[model samples]
Every structure is written in C-alpha cells, then in structure tokens.
Target: MVVIDINKKYPEIWEFLAEVPDPEIPIINLVELGVVRNVEKEGDKVIVTITPTYTGCPAKKLFEDLIREKLIEKGFEDVQIDTTLSPAWNTDWLSEATKAKMMADGISPPTDDNKVVTCPNCKSTNTKIISKFGSTPCQSFHSCNDCLEPFNYFKCHR
Candidate 1:
C-alpha cells in the first residue's frame, strides 16, 4: 500500500500514467490494473517504478514503452522507468473498484481466497475451471454451469 501511496504523491504523473492502458487488457488502465507501483518527481525528471504482474509477463517491455511515451507526450522529456521486484506484485494490489470494472467487462477478477470465481456473464457461482491457462498466462479459463458461458478468471497471485 505504501508503494501505491507514492502514486498519489505525484498526482499529475499518476494521471499521465493512468491514461496509458494495459497492452493486453485495453479496457483497464495500467494504474487501475496495479501495474504502476510508484511515481516520483525530481527536478525536471519523473521517475516511474512499475512491477510486472508476473516475472515472466510478456508485456513488460510494452508497459515501459507505453509509460515512457505517455509521459513524453505530456511534455516530460526525462522519464525514467524503474522495475522493482522487492516486495513483488500480488492480486491484493487490485482494488474492489477495479475488480468491479473488470467483472462488468465480462472478465472475472481475482479473489482473496480464490475459492469462488463468479461468472461475469451471468453472475453465477456455479462455475468450474476449464483450464489452468486461459488466453493469457495471467488468466485461467472457466465455464459457467448456469449460463453455459466460457470466460477467463484473473488468477490469484501472491
């Protein structure tokens, strides 16, 4: 939470990053997706620290490029990106609001215990895991028994 709070310390920088959407999930911005870890301002330079959802995340380079581009587009010439794995990233970083937004978009967000991943299509708890891997590495495929709809569940990572 302390790292997230650093984002608030620089509202403008955070806002700039917020405009940069996730490369895969374009519906959600990087900030809301919990990819952006910290933001700091030093003189004429802006430092942004980000943590990948997972170490092997393929979108790592794209995330940095998008962030740098967005900041530069906002008139920031010196934008430094720092990748940190100190505390690491976890599903707990996602907020309730962000989860709701994901759910509304037909993607089940991760849960605390991950015991139940409701179907976003029908809001049914009667679901079963279809595959350990979904269309993406961070998600798992699932099917809703009631609605008979296939969906992806954002896997719980800690």
Candidate 2:
C-alpha cells in the first residue's frame, strides 16, 4: 500500500525514463504502469528498482534490458537493475491517466474488485469473460454484449 512518489523523488531520471514503453502495450510507459519502482543515483552509478506485473512475467528480462539500454542511450555509464517483489505490483498502482490511456486504446483497465467488468468500446456493463487469460497473462479476454467487440480487461493483480 506504500506508493513511492517517485516522480518527485527522482524527477530527472523518472522524466527521462518515461519514454520506455511497455512492449505489450505500446501506448503506455513502463514507469507509469508501476513496473519501475525506486531509482537511486550514487556517484556515477544509477540503480533502478522494478517489480514485474506477475512473478513469472515473460517480459521481465526485456524490461531489465530496455531500462539498461535506455540509460546507456541517455549517457549513463553504470546502470544497475534491481528487482523487488516485496510489495508486489498491483493494478491500483496504475494512475487514473494510465487507466484512461488504456481505455482509449480499447483495453479495459481494472476497476474495483467487486465491480463488474466494463466494456471499453461502449462503456457497457453487460460483458462476458471470454477467457481468463487474454493475449497476455495480465489481461483477461472479454466480449461486450452491447458493442459486440472483444477486448482485453487488464486483470487486477494486488
């Protein structure tokens, strides 16, 4: 439940690293998705802490490499990547703006745990879960009854 105000704490680094997009969802950046956690700069070394959306996430290695490459591309020499699973990444970490972006992209962002799924295409509550797993393990396949469009609902992970 402890969300770090990373933007303010590591303003320079965070702002620059915001360009690294999620491989699966190109519209969203990794930083705002809550995958990238803490950032520390010690001397010439920069440490980036991250938590995967899922423990066995397939993009885990890609995330580390992308972050390292981006840092190096930005003139960083010694970049250290660290993984932390203590607090666990959750959908709640996603900001309202992030959710909005997901919605705009035709992917339904997670809502309250008790609420029914909403169709991103037409904002309809009448939706059916097509599959527990969508294109990615973090999302679930759903079809909207009103729009008749199939979409992915970013699964709630906490």
Candidate 1 Cα outliers beyond 4 Å, as residue runs: 1-4
**lDDT tens digits by residue: candidate 1, 32-114:** 88878788889999999988888889999999999999999999999999999867787777888989988998889998667
Task: Report how far residue 111 has shifted in candidate 1, in Å.
Answer: 1.4
Q: Write candidate 2's Cα lDDT for 1-158 as tens digits.
A: 45656555768888777999999998899987899888898999999999999988899999999999998998999999999997878888899999999999999999887268989989999999989988987999999999899999998776
Give the clashing pairs for model 1.
Answer: none
Q: What would the TM-scores of all predictions be? A: 0.94, 0.94
Deviation (Å) of 19 in candidate 1: 0.8
Model number with the top lDDT: 2
> How far is 66's C-alpha from truth in model 1 (Å)?
0.2
**What lDDT is obtained when candidate 2 is compared to the true structure?**
0.88
Clashes of each: 0, 0
Quickly count the clashes in candidate 1: 0
